[model samples]
Target: MSQTHSGTDATGAPVNAPEHVIVIGGGISGLAAAHRLAGAGVRVTLLEASSRLGGKLYADEIAGVPVDLGAESLLARRPEATGLAREVGLGDDLEPPAVLGAALWTRGKLRPMPKGHVMGVPGDLGPLASSGVLSAAGLARLPLDHVLPRTDIGDDVAVGAFVAARLGHEVVDRLVEPLLGGVYAGNAYEISLRAAVPQLFAAMREGRSLIEAARGIQRRAAASAGGGPVFNGIRGGVGRLPLAVAEACRALGVTIETDTAVRELRRTPHGWQVVLDGRALAADAVVLAAPAPVAARLLAAESPAAAAELGGVEYASMALVTMAYRRRDMTRLPYSSGFLVPPVDGRTIKASTFSGRKWGWLGEAGGDTFVLRTSVGRHGDEADLAWDDTDLVRLSREDLEAAVGLRAAPVAARVTRWDAGLPQYPVGHLDKVARIREQVAKLPGLALCGAVYEGVGIPACIASGQRAAADILPGIVAAGS
Candidate 1:
């Protein structure tokens, strides 16, 4: 860990150092990079623009309990994030969701998420047949997917179009759209299917029928030991994971400077020059792990091609309202994790999670306390995100009352707003990403990684960071040799 005011090498040499690296952005990606570099014996400095670390990994105490305002959970099957956790000695802290149940708010009622439905696409017909979430007519409409002819268009297509074409409009509007729409805060009509759900696309390309593909997957899993475990989170809160990562990085002697924003990056003859607080720091390698737009601005003058492509990626704004109330105030607590509301419902909220029921530790035996997390916003409804705290809470409360029978005032309430947080993978996102990668590869001693490229979840961010670290460390080692 080195921070030189004069931007010179350790030997006080005015020349460029062989193994000096600077990682911009102190989020999960930046932390992962700095930690990896330090572990590999590379001198690294991580710079963050915010007053505190964890850009979108924010957590604060509410009513004496930790509440996550940003990312809350990680899919266990995503090895990158979970692998990082284990490496950082936080593996034991991981816990699966107490209750695997979830609901869908439809037709002005709360309905359980159809069992055996992987992310809203039915894997088994039995669950869909038994699920009251959809009518028998809607369930019958799903079999149409088997007969749907394959389309050979070699261009990006919206998720909505793909779902509607393969399945029925009811499946898209009632099942797939709202569930996925809430996750991305994006419009299925515009979001790219390749970028959003590549696995489903691959299944379609390979099996010709989603039902057949899903059945094949089930058979394979049953024949084997079993499929991967469902999603999991930290026992305390999702914030603990980042906190542990940051701590591990610090323990490895990585210098983390929060509130130090990197304004620009310039290519020098030997290495790179980074501008921050009107001061410049020179390093052998630089990693831009910030948001796509921020990264674009930093590299605009240095790599115009990369910057242009990065700037083209779009992001959507979203808001979360977590409220705590007495369980007795509600009509009945469903044995479900949470519920997703379809956009066609014209409701103010996109989805609502039964925080207390989602996990066992979150609730008590015969206790009356319950916490609910409600999300608001999508591509067309950006205005909802712009609402002030008062209005936001009011709107969320109104939706809660209609979705779940909540009448009592919340004992606790908090609102978190993210401007341009959720990345929208519009049609052709992969092509643009390819171009960006090509331009990035042309630049020596520079790497780019973040949620905008591979995935939007924590696991993807960690994977991106680790991959960047892997790329930068070898150069450092060879330079030192």
Candidate 2:
């Protein structure tokens, strides 16, 4: 057990005690934070309200074969996620997608996704026009972006509104919304330009047209990235990442407890007192890695200002319906990884991923069985989620039949619903995050991290955790001396 002291020296200075840090929440973010703190030789205790770890990254069996029911891939371009995977002994298991490129299911057909676009804001109109993704009038109006006056993006603006003004509604509705939806599960018209796509926002601030900005971004990426795979996954499942991280933390002597809810948090003269159901734990520092609402409730009495800001952060709910089928039952397989559906098409499902085709391991493991999954629900359009699991699977099959001529029945099906899965970023979300951080910083030994901050991606969440660990380390080091 770590030594806990609650007194001051003769000079009124805080008495030194061995650093004991507590991390609330057992998601990837919390695990990452605990790993970092433990690596620094601090005695750390991680508490989770749930029975299991890996909040959004979960793996399960479908038809006697392992499959990822939650997040299946990681952005290979980002180092945080991939780097963490390597650190946790998954270095050799990292596998890139077997297939690449996807189609956009719009206009009653599947059109090849156009090249040279930043989140579907076309840089080269030639491919966009040839792709048949837009109507004649929409194609003609695209050039108007070059002639429009510079719109004042005072503090922040909506991604859809800015792109619609510079291009037109067709572009935002057909391309931007669907692409952004895949990431945020929120309407582009409501998402923040500054928070969602900072690079595009920066380019626009320099007086360049959206087209030029997108082209430049593509060119720079091509030159610097050397055409590496955009995404990567583990051989078994990306969901195994958090489990591996937790194991590494345990090896380092970090204490992790699940099904343990933290009821209250109070600041002590020396550090903090974390109140639970029957007892309390003392720590030199605390990392709040819970979701926004949970964090708000825990911090209400300690930091009301920060709690209010966290309370304002909204979230989007979603579900993934996974199904497995016999390969012989299908007449043809999807050529690419998958396709994204535009909401304007009035589809029940938002997107589908051909797991067997996308992941080489899954294909080889399944042998005669083919697997695929479809996502349902979004920010404001979650009525579909109210349906039961069987209904969601049925609705998914109905759309799959229309989108890809998939009429065969599956051998097994599973529905994984992530209620409030992703955090939504409104117009001034970045500014709001800054205020929340400022308020938390005022309280010594308190720091925050999660999808509610900079981003919702796996890498972003890991980076957020690392940042929180770094923030409180200095205080812990000083008190230990």
Candidate 3:
């Protein structure tokens, strides 16, 4: 349930005016904010350019079974998403992965992923060797991290460069690349360490052994969670989250308008005005939950500096090929949950998840068929995306066959393309976001929040949206008073 707010005057009477906030965008972030504001008795008018809500979180049917075409898992360490799910009556359906581990297909073999890692930064060297992710020569050089002279990273360094300096190129190429790709779809060499893995970056700044630092961090994480699940998913699908939030918004009396794009956003004498469907909708405040480019265009006139900064924020496009196969096929199942393919592996499919093994619920619905998803086309891989869905499926199967030696035709297949789906946090990205936020602060009643500003995870996006709502809530109350 949304929290209550104390907005009444000392005598518990009406103030200057009713607080009204116009929220732009219909993604998870915007929906969450609208829900909160509405619960606080603030009239909310939300404008979504698309025909439906849930920007990237989507649920669809495949072979008569409900499935998610976009993000599917939630990091349980963060309470934002899981907490909201409970508030929306999804608490009973929360589940963790059945299998806890994954594999890596690299260097002409399938190997177990090394354990004790903070995004591929190894805390223990034993698993790295046992997993065969690195060669004997590669393993030999890991100890040099102790003898090698200390390296200095000024403000921030690329994750690849920093890890390679400490661990080795092999670790960055095979371990870090695929791990980062699962979320960023970008090269590890260009990802910002400070932004992507802050704890590890802080460890590096402490001027100690990264291995020891990783172990310490891992111990703290384990102690904090008390050995609970690290990740969770809804029984139906993660895509259901947005729908629940939207329904809650409705219950709170939020006016949600779909296919209503905000074409113009201008500052008025009172506060802010948004022109949509040829009519101006004015409100005391505005919350921006759109993508960087969309937000940039909307705020260009009011704050050109912020708009330019947002425009510079880049994005990565990718596609998913989901296929269901009959269990009778003459093949074997992967021992682990799935496998990740590093970009250096020279394969078309970047990663494959054994949904059947990972999600026990998927087995309950999928009686005779085993389902899995293959992801392809990361950042700087435009040529791979040029192929149509059919060819994409073919290439995915080809790569799957080479990796797992499964030639059985898929009983059913579905391809979903996400053009510029995820934002890319290159080096110095946090600084850019800081500049954008600072510039936006100068404009009254204008706040921006999305995957571009802080984080790309569902929880992070929700937090960002809630923060935006909180930032303007005080001003909205004061203006009304």
Winning model by lDDT: 2
Q: Candidate 3 residues 48-132, lDDT tens each?
A: 9989899889877678767778898999988889988887778998999896589999999888888898899888888898898
Query: Given candidate 2, what's the lDDT at residue 326?
Result: 98
lDDT of 1 by residue, 1-481 (tens): 2423223333655543237889998888888888778877777888988887876778675555556777778877667777778878878877777756777888778876776654466777777666676666777777787677765535667878876776667777877788678668888878887788776666666645776765665565456534556577776677777778888888888778887988779988877998888799998889889999998898788789989988888888888888877777755655677789888888889988877777665664215767778888877678777778888888988887887766678788889888888788888998888898898878877887888887778887887888787666553221111
Q: List the residue pairs that clash in candidate 1.
A: 101-337, 327-368
For all predicted structures, in order, the TM-scores are 0.90, 0.95, 0.94
Worst 10 residues of 1 by lDDT: 472-481
**Ranking 2 against 3 by lDDT, winner:** 2
> If ranked by lDDT, best first, what sequence of candidates would result?
2, 3, 1
Per-prediction tally of clashes? 2, 0, 0
Considering only N, C-alpha and C atoms within 3 Å, which residue pairs clash in candidate 3? none
**lDDT string, candidate 2, 30-125, tens digits:** 998888888877788999999999999998789988899899889887788988899899999999998577999999988999888999888888
Worst 10 residues of 2 by lDDT: 472-481
lDDT of 3: 0.85
